[model samples]
Target: MQSLSNRLQTQPDASTATALLQLQAQVDGDPSPAPSSDLDGMSLGGLKRKRCRGDFEVCALGGEVGRDVVERGLVTGEEAALYFGTFFQGCDKYVPVFDPSYDTFDSIRRRSSMLFDTIITIGCRAENGAVSSQYQALSNTTKSPIAEVLLGTTLPSIETIQALLINACYSEKGWMLTSMAVRMALDLELPDAYTQLCEIMLQGSDNVERERDLFRKARVWFGTFVLEHILSLDCGKRPGVRADGVAMRRCRVLLGSSARTTLDFRLLAQVEVCELLSSGDAGADVLLALAHDRLSPRVGVALSDRELGEIVQGTRIDLSIWLSDWITLVETAGATEEEKASLVVNLKIQRDWSEMTMLCKGLQGIGIDNVAIMSEEQRNLIRLAKISAQRHMSTIMSNTGLYLGGFRYGMDFVWAKCAFSVLLLLKLTRLLPESSNMPQLIADSKVLLAELSKVRGLNNIYFRILSLSVEKCERALKEDLAQAANPQNSGTQLNFPDAEMEFQSYVPKEFILEWSFPGLTFCWIPFDFQDLLMDFGSGL
Candidate 1:
């Protein structure tokens, strides 16, 4: 088990020769102010004095010392072994700086694959400890370090790296360390390290599906790992948590499943915080944040003075960062347009949809109340802002749909299907509000599904798409009916008061259910203006 401890390296690379020289000076601080005089140390007698214990024991103390002596000899071995035993432990750490074969090797460099195979074959032979020592005599003594330092450091040349591809060569714990390494590399822009790690994962395993399993099924465990390592309260667009200053992993969890046991086609989302609270799951909160962030930029017209009074206000958890994460996640989801459309439709039905709808309503309540005190001009600006926000949100919603619809990342996720349904539903609630042109929007959205149906394994997606569209159409009419029947006591125009009188009679639950999703119409709506997007944007 690789602990997060692997993320830290106390001896960060010394970038320049001066830095390296400074470090060497620090380590040799106690020895002497400068190299021992002896007139350039010419009288130092073959330099037997300075060596590490591992090297010293073999040369100094020629006899196999008793355990007691061995135990005693360990205190500052370099000092004790040389002074007490008249022998040395340390060897010069520097390997030779040149290799004779380098010139010839350059000609064979074009056959890099063959050269690598031969080198690995030699390494494998050295796997046995005895063979390793014997082989080290030949290669380390003759070629290896000198060759590498000369080729990599001394000359202006491409440094060749040895890498192999392995998929799912990682365990839940392994991924955490790997994730930290990846993040650190990304932050520092360490091209060499990042490339090295990506190569290791690619060569270590061939199971992409297993890799995804670690993504969804192990999120809780993964979250545990992340929380342990990543601890910073200053929330930002980029994850701020770090393991000893190394960036923590960014986790993506799938909450819903729509396919068979071995195949899970569902909503995949990047959730910032994975903890759960009575208020909601961190993942759920992330969706709410995404919705809000997506809506922030748009300025909408304000509500009438009377309507503004109804807006209830309270502080909400700030999720400005979540919106940015969502934006990137959704935008990168699908490789194509039709796939994107199917994803949008599927996302609309995700589990978070219903809850998100409610959450958005809460936001609307606060917003409306705040605007209630404003004049008509203020209300108009709010209205436009809301309208613009609704449009922008639709873009995110659409992009999310496209991504989820295209990727067939299999499902080993436990309880993911249910959770996904909830998110999709919540997302839909936020995306689809009562629109004046609900029928046209529904029609427009249908074309997206039709385009998506061409993709393989997406027939069911089209079916779900159809089901949700039918549901949206009926709810639009239902909303119209509800408003006409009991108009808001706050003065507003009534569309069909006569029809409203018989709304209960005109739109029975059973009749709507005959065509749309069960319980969909009444699921919930967050902000009334969301209806305007479905009604207007869809037709676009």
Candidate 2:
């Protein structure tokens, strides 16, 4: 009988070939297989395995066939190119760590098939329905590999981290994926890449390619850090990555370097915004801590109305300053008029969002026990929150094109922010007297939510929640208007038997548990709408 190695080398299947390669590498005292000049006579799946081992030519020739055979899917070279172009053009702007000029489809595919598939999935999902129909199959193909990497069954690389971060923007398990990405990034010591790159710069190394590679790794770490904060804010959880002043300084220096692009500047600006929003001094942070205590058995001291006011005012001032500084930088950064407009719009929206967050925190801090005789400061905070919600919703409504066009391509947090604005407006409408423009605002918000819901690849939970919430709010507002118009009916309460049943039917319990509303914790229970609405009015 022939030896095991001889049998494997003579007629190797994909699994046996991989095992043989690993054994050979172990014998050679190297963990990775070395490049071999001799080509193995293997089938398509085995060819895919060889391609994964750095045979670029094999991948270039049989890439589609190998993927079709292994993943049970097919993406022709032309389709791959189109999807790659789509991702870099639309989606890559938000996640700017990946450089299209440097990482072409062929190059990325050669580096990691998982990353390649992730890019294609996102790109496909960003397209119109006709094109996006392929998204599900492609996305399905990526799940197994991603799970393997996440479970430690497959070793992770920087490419895996990038794939996870990008997919997290669209995945239902976004928070989990983001947490894993941060952990993998730390394990890879990506945070230290910047220091090493700086050392090389100081040493006067003339290796441009080496410097570029280090910059990419540094960008990846920053991307992970930024994503961690964004997802944390969305879920009302503390970020996995702590605030690092030295890391921020390093990021600033990197952005100021000649190699920095407009995208890098935008990412740095996001880092700064997240930093300010998550600061201990920020009202959002205070509220998050309070929320934790509320959910726990331990009783915590509530902030005085005066203290809450100060926090809100201080947060507003900080947000204003931050916005002003970034606006100036954005204008002077040599970006085009369109880019400037988009940046300014985003900044103003964030400013409004932060203000609303602070005001909501203030509202929550003011206990409902004394709703009838609320403090003047508390009333003022409610007024400010209402105005901020109005302004934020108005911005979203007016920039319908921007949000709708970019919704599929941007981060999931954008959808969360929009949902928060709608819910805030709903809460404030009940707390405060009905304004002349409240109906119009509600109508516009409905339209905005409807359009956003139509965006491809959007998480359906957001749409279902927002749609049902808006419907209930509108019905309640109409009832209030009717009661005021007729004194006899003023004492009569509106019943929502059908609405309640529909909401229960549409919104699953798991979705309620999974989807965290930023400031509207009460929204998790649709059945408690009456109580929550009364609670909002209780502090009025």
Candidate 3:
């Protein structure tokens, strides 16, 4: 049998749990010296597990953490409640998964130990070392003991899955944790008719029983599906859940809500995005024939300009229809001010992304060398891209809190939109050097990026890279423009036949590859561009 330690090592989402266990060992002054030999091939199951006698630390501030435990961590019940409210409330709004009315404190403590541990860990990290030096210390630790718990306990229950997801939402390493939760959820095989039948039979009232059990489970499963899909989409990976399986029409009936809520609309919008990006329908492929060829040079022959224009038009119409449906639903849903503002901004960001994708496709179809003398269709595509880029930046500025908090609350796609928008500006500057607004756009993006960097302990690596990449792109543009202004002072002779190709090559290929971002290596989507620019450093 696999040892507990080995099992914990295998689980991706167990980082926080594993770290806590290690900390507990250190705090208790574990006398068990480090291992003498590398037990690479040996199993550790035979070793006796250490049992700490101290009372467990309750993360909530100003709440009872039991009277007995020594070395109490800084968290009080009040603070823990706040973290839960901020990170999990968005989903709970629609699904009613964390309903306090139904979930008593004792019930949660007994049933959701894993969740309790996770919340405390997250609170420590978020505190930024203010409460104690250990908070900062725990924030740096990356180890997890997730496997031991999984092996030692019975198969995970739905309640356990719910806690794991809530924990994942607040975690810095969300994608890994969410991936593990997705697997466990699948293994649990939740929402089957047998469980619903049992609940109905037990309660003697189908409506009341279904409301408590069936609807609850359905909502939890939908939330899981939404997170799983969004994580996969943002990282450019194939989603683990089936899109058709979580259809909104069926979910609404299962939820039993009088009208669809904001959370439901958000989930539906995400599902649509997943479909839009990953759909393999023949019609979409035919529409994007040129883009398909540009993405993969092996196809050799590319589609004509007319064909590319037709594809862009088709994509626009599809996006329009998708937006209209969601807009109507959101307007009807009685959402709070914060929810309304965030949801509307999210939709706008998605629209901008869709517009950027289509326009870039059109630009690629025309061949970069000919952009200086563009056709009406090509110019329109460029114009649309610029407008969308500006709109995305402005939207983010207006709703700064939403996108910044997005890093912590499972709204990573919002940040991904911001990163992609910066790239769009880089592309525009490189292709349309003469456009007066490009310089102002680049400067505005830098200002916004600097503000994002101010976020305490931000975990998104790609977002950080935006600052460096933008600076490099701007420097390259300056050099190219200087050479153009004074050809006599150029340091080196240009060997390339076309100046446009030379200017295009200045940006590095490393930044363009989707896998350049962490945790995206396994993604097979054609969206990952290997290199749009050759060398931004060289003179055009």
Best by lDDT: 2
TM-score of 1: 0.27
Better of 2 and 3 by lDDT: 2
Clashes of each: 66, 0, 17
Model 1, runs deviating above 4 Å? 1-220, 223-271, 275-317, 325-355, 358-393, 396-440, 456-465, 471-540
* Candidate 3, superposed: residue stretches over 4 Å from native: 1-82, 85-107, 127-145, 148-154, 163-179, 191-209, 245-262, 272-312, 354-387, 405-417, 433-436, 457-463, 480-540
- Location of the lowest summed lDDT over 10 successive residues in candidate 3: 519-528
- lDDT for model 2 comes to 0.62
lDDT of 3 by residue, 1-540 (tens): 222122221233453344434444544787644332211112222223332224432122212222211124445666555544543444343223444544544455455544454444544444442235644443322123344333322234566566656555544445566666666655554434323533444455647545555545555555666565544434445455443222233332322252234565565465445444434321111123223433322446665667666766667676666667667667766778778767776676666665665466556544543444566666667766666666767777777777555543333344554565676566665555455465676687777776676654245655665665576667666776777898877754433323434434434343344321211111111111212233343432
C-alpha RMSD between model 2 and the true structure: 10.4
For candidate 1, write residues 1-540 as lDDT tens digits: 133324433233224233324334645664434333211211121122221233232122112211222233322333322322210000000000111223123332342322222233232222322134433342222233223222222111111111000000111122233333333232232323322333335466666554443333232223322322221111112222223322222223232211111111122232233222112323322233333333222456434434332321111222323334554555555435553444334333332332333233333433433332434553443333334334433543456444433322211110122222332333333333434344444454455445434433243333354445445445655666666686663244323233222321222332222111112222222244455557788895
Best model number under TM-score: 2
lDDT of 2 by residue, 395-467 (tens): 8788887756677666555655566578667666555654637678678877887687667534545566577
Query: Worst lDDT window (10 residues) for model 1?
Result: 87-96
RMSD of each: 23.0, 10.4, 11.4
Model 2: colliding residue pairs:
none
Candidate 2: clashing residue pairs, number? 0
